[model samples]
Target: MNFKKIIVSAVAIAAFAGFTGAASAAIREVNEWGASAQFLYWSAQAPNYLQNIGCYNGGWTKTGPTSKYQVSVGTCANGDTFIFRVGEKSSFDGPLSVMGSTTDPNRGSIDPQEGCGDANPRQRLMTDETTCSGASCTARKCVDITVGASDVEGESFTQVSHGMKYGPSTATNNVWIDRAFSAIDTSSLANTRKLVVPFGEFVNNTVTKNGVTIDNLTRHQVVQIYSGQAWYWQDFGGDYTSLPITRCFRHAGSGTHATLDKTVMHSPWGGALLTDESLVDPLTWFNDSSSDLMKCINTIDGAIGYADADQIQKVGAGQTYPNVSAVKYNGVMPTRATIANGEYDNHWAVQNCYYRPTDAEAAAVCNAVKNVPSSKAGFWATTCEMTYMKDKDWTYPVYVGATCEAGPSCSDGLDNDFDGSADAADTDCQ
Candidate 1:
């Protein structure tokens, strides 16, 4: 069977069903009601949000085969469409416009020619070539949302604050933060930067190693390994008694590296670097994508690396990295529950939805995109988090403030422990 023809047929069928009233009146939204929204998000869990959009209430349908990274297209009840472009959290440097110029159109652009050379359209989108030129880009007809690479969360607000500080852009930036980009300083940003909405939580910067047994590590031990203080597996209680621990890092521009730097190596506020630079030998360190990191862990015994917890889980589930698994930090495994509850101390940045705050047209489009029916509260990805951790159903609301709290009231006679502490608060609450 021709896979290309099959994928084309499948997409056409889905779209036709969407418009043919077979999808329900709620899904037949008029174009005037709202414009489509596009999002360029960089988070390991970005696909969870995209897949959830398709499975949201059956009003939308996901057409492509499932993959760890895929562009998703969904039509909502009000005829409003949603397009998602996602990438590795580490590669997300800034908005797509930050790189593309007329002189170098492909600078920030996702070229199907290069990224999708051998893959079919559907496979291309799923495999990170989510963008294309002209009519070939069928994820969404209108360019309402666009995103950039690596971890959008890893970017400090300092990067985008300047552009929004003075005033709104003269033209449409055309980028929407689906999962909001994490900002280092929310207070430093202008109030008008309202469009940079926060949503969802993630456990990023997880340490992983091969299936070899090792003692549960503390943040201190993890730091020791990366900072070059710990040389042998014996230093960290690994099975490889004589092997020297190999260090692997993501690229500098990677959000994964940024989050690991801030959460594991840097000071609390990330104002200063924290690693012992002199000890870290660049020659011995490996730097590449998470997939590449997985390969490194598989091939190089006593190797250790970091990536998003969700990415690790997805890879493990796919059995793609059979030799690798997530390493426990402080004796607590990085699970959906630990990440959601903030128990996993080395949590990554909150995913943010970045958009042009002052651009009314863009805002309207984005608002419509996110505010689809049955999407105001949760998505499939969040639901997966609940299911994966065997917790109650959850929602992926727009990011507002710290989901993790502390202080006196945190120890109050309420549900401080998140265990339904109706009367007596758990000691852990304190």
Candidate 2:
């Protein structure tokens, strides 16, 4: 598979975000579409922060499979309306658009809009005065999109693109809130499968459940699925009728996707690395937004992917994410208790705001997001609340405090929780 084509598709899909066909008049855009921020990490949390700080429709949803996953448009307090596009583009577009460079040389200018030849009209154009065209394109007035997002951070996307350390954000232009990433799947049943590692190739073929044999989706199995080693549910003992596993993935530049690369494929705690996300394009399915990915997974059986867990729990217009569910990794689930304590730490992300410093409106929008503490929004991965800490992604965590016994103390033969039974016998330990 051609790697460059995958990036081109990411930019194109972002160009055609879900809002272009929205049915809500109340949330109809008024900006006449000035140059939108090329990158936005958490579109789900943008509307509220923009609304509280002042984008009017900040909370309005442009319909999608679920209102919760739809794009948000609002007239902010500053009276400027900005639309934060949903899905994977936010992470993909941020670094390239802000720095004005492209990884693809054939696409165009040395720094031309992500090697796509010309600047993407919607990404860099800040004002309605001129469109991006002509022999030499004008520099875009970077629009800042400050959002309190969950799951993958725009900075992590930058880290993958630049190969930088994951602790501090490589893209300083992007501000952040907090978030936690989740490894997801097509069915809730997948969660209950007894976690087991495959010792050899083709071992999944005979594995089963209920005194019968079925393949289990261990972390190692997930790495295989994404890396093209496992092609169908039958390949791993899953009972799903579908053949040829559908790898639902966010586009090349998505922070969620990048985090996926680190959390599973190239992870420090891993087997069978996914060398290049685009390398497995033949067996993969891509979506630009988190919502779209949900739809993709829900529509297809035997499909697996990852996304911001916060959005997975959200409901829209009496609708919830149906058929799609997050599964446990190595017997541990991605919950606040497990994630913060280092028991379920893979793909835990830190979010940040991304915008052009020159654009005062963008800065104001980001400032609005900063005012809302991550704690208020629920499960935004506040470091102070965590019992374990780590310096970079793909590295196991170190116990930072003793507040939670779920990790280590759960096994100490004594009564760690004073309830009588200790070790594996205690409910708290369980």
Candidate 3:
């Protein structure tokens, strides 16, 4: 007999003997639930968190025929699955569960609101450029080719969720909000509740053209750079031989932009150092895409910019940007410990989940969605801003929020919220 026949016969014999092998021996099957959601570009780390919770059997699979944003699919063990798409938070003005084709007039094209011109470009796969078919750039459409009902295999996965880094108030004023109007008060419109959790911080980096790097910068120096007060590389130090300090920033609708402005640029008296002339400088570039922003920094000499620390880890780790380095703020490097302990005073961006109040199906999944960090033991004590963070000993932080003892014996001054008075002396004990 052939070796193939002999192998098949051996496998058949094992099956007949009721032998159960490793999990990889057979295909894993699932039949529980599925969902689809659209979220902000900064939260690109979200898929990592989802995959860690076993929501996906193996890992996330990237799929999308459009360049406007990113799309990833996760297949669960119960036959349930989910799809995630990345876009500016402002563009998502409706329910997280809205299902439509890539060709639909509203959902089909990237509009001018996202800093692209008003030509209404079609979505490319991974590039940020719009599609134009005609000679005059008149015929433009998104190029996404994924088509099918939101449901898979004729069965429906009932839960849908939407995520963003900013709150509804900020989302309303952004020109990219794609709803008929930018009102986020869903109390009258649908079943939605604004869920919030402490998110991650952003870190600004001072990169050189090639030879050298600036290790740290004071808040005042950063303000001067963005405000046009510091225009040349020599202004900070004679660290590099490059001239013309290049400043790059995210476009106006970005959540990172808002956070930077609030934390780094704002004055003590409710003012800003960046003037109109500085913001509108021809030399500066307002990039709308994070990848594009990184590319800009990598390609430009003497370039300086800010991005989510987690985002930088995702791309800046082993990719391009060989000449660039992250700046330590006030002698402290950006890390989960620094941010958690409030050592790094800037870049505390948040993660929010919004769903319609009437959508009970979406609401059902809120626990798994909101408790992403705490769900995994020692994953994130009270944060959901990154894929994962370990302490100095490389272990998960101990979570003491709900699990903290609330009664008389539990009161300890060292533990927060326990009231300094220990034992029965603390009101918490009573």
For all predicted structures, in order, the TM-scores are 0.48, 0.49, 0.49
- Give the Cα-based TM-score of candidate 1 against the true structure: 0.48
**In model 2, which range of ten residues has the least summed lDDT?**
190-199
* Model 1 agreement with the true structure over 1-430: per-residue lDDT tens digits: 1000001123334444434454434321111100011112222123333333342232222322222233434554445454444332233423332222233222232333223322221122232224443323324222222322223332342111001110111325322221222332222211111111111111112332353355366677666666666777666544345566666544343445555655556543323322211223321333334555555565555566766554443444356666565656777656545544445564344333333343332223223221111221111112222211211011123323332222113324555325556424443222
Model 2 accuracy (lDDT, Cα): 0.40
Tens-digit lDDT track of model 2 for 22-46: 4442332311111111122234344
Local distance difference test, each candidate = 0.35, 0.40, 0.37
Error of 3 at 150 (Å): 23
Candidate 1: where are CA atoms >4 Å away? 1-91, 96-212, 236-240, 267-283, 312-318, 359-430
Q: Which 10-residue span in candidate 3 carries the lowest summed lDDT?
A: 148-157
Kindly report which residue stretches of model 2 are placed more than 4 angstroms away from their true locations once superposed: 1-88, 101-216, 238-243, 267-282, 314-321, 355-378, 401-430
Looking at model 1, residue 210 earns an lDDT score of: 54
lDDT: which candidate is best?
2
